[model samples]
Target: MSIADPAAVREHLLAAAAAGHPLTYSELLGRLGHAFTRPKMRALCVTLAAIDEAAEAAGEPELAVLVVRQSDGLPGQGWWTGSWERHRFTGEWTGPEARRLIERLQGEAYRYWQERRGG
Candidate 1:
């Protein structure tokens, strides 16, 4: 959609998500264009990647932990659901805690999905 305003960009993303047409990595890049090229935005993307990597580091079981970007429907632009609840985050909210957030979510998901063989 090539929205120049970040707020507008958020709105479009929300609408698209509602329609089951959520943006992919490349699609979001192209649509937002330079709007997210600023230092903070770039840092946030980097942080998200690091979070994903850290979550992956927990091994195959944690790989099933799904991470998603909230599109205004949630409290933050970045979000993940644990076995118990949902967590939402934004760069302005906590720029460096992405890794910990994902790790916690991975733990929760792993625990939630683990097979109960000994019961």
Candidate 2:
């Protein structure tokens, strides 16, 4: 069981989210090509929580969407459960789905940071 390339997975996820599409398992494999594996994919999903934590520390509320966990679904699937202003959203997501959502938000945050830095 090899690990998926986190960076590649992250990039793909971010691009998909930016494009406004849900991340699907099949899609992930397609994007990853022969580099895909079940264990690596699962690990990638688990890593999303860390991204959320970082966003919270950075004081970005919208990024909280990545931290929320799904309550009613398979072990590796579900949607955001954390506080998002006044509303909450839920849905299914494979490993790729979670990764993409976090990456997309992070990309936005990165742009915000760059703007703040006057770059």
Candidate 3:
């Protein structure tokens, strides 16, 4: 169940929720087919947060909200920086919200990486 696709990643999250399991970063990445050392995973999560923030500020509120809501339990930064920190939100978000956020951000990130690589 490699979460190489954003939609597949979302589906996996939904499946986890349906199974009455809590979503975690490690779990998400496990579905994604890449195992990140804690530090690497932390870095990647931080990058997602930064992208979310920037996207929100740039009038992409939907994307921003999705990231913020989905990445609730996942690790992130307290403040925007290269440094990674754990972020815990007050309320739990639904599986749909998490899927939406993960899909959108993952798609955007993939496209960005593809362009960079192609160039």
Candidate with the greatest lDDT versus the true structure: 2
| Ranking of all predicted structures according to lDDT, beginning with the best and ending with the worst | 2, 3, 1
**RMSD each, Å:** 14.0, 8.5, 11.0
Candidate 1 Cα outliers beyond 4 Å, as residue runs: 1-5, 34-85, 88-119
Residue pairs clashing, model 3: 3-31
Ranking by TM-score: 2, 3, 1
1-119: candidate 2 lDDT, tens digit per residue? 11234445555544544454334554455556644466645565555445445545767533323222234212243224432333332334446665565566646655654455443
Name the top TM-score candidate.
Answer: 2
Q: What is the lDDT of residue 72 in candidate 1?
A: 26
Which lDDT tens digits does candidate 1 get at residues 23-99? 44334555555444445344434444444355457542332223233432221243332222334444343344654
Task: Give the lowest summed-lDDT range of ten residues in model 1.
Answer: 72-81
Q: 91, model 3: CA deviation in Å?
A: 12
- 61-91, model 3: which lDDT tens digit per residue? 2122122223464224332232222223233
Q: In candidate 3, which residue ranges exceed 4 Å CA deviation?
A: 1-4, 38-75, 78-119
C-alpha local distance difference test of each model: 0.40, 0.45, 0.42
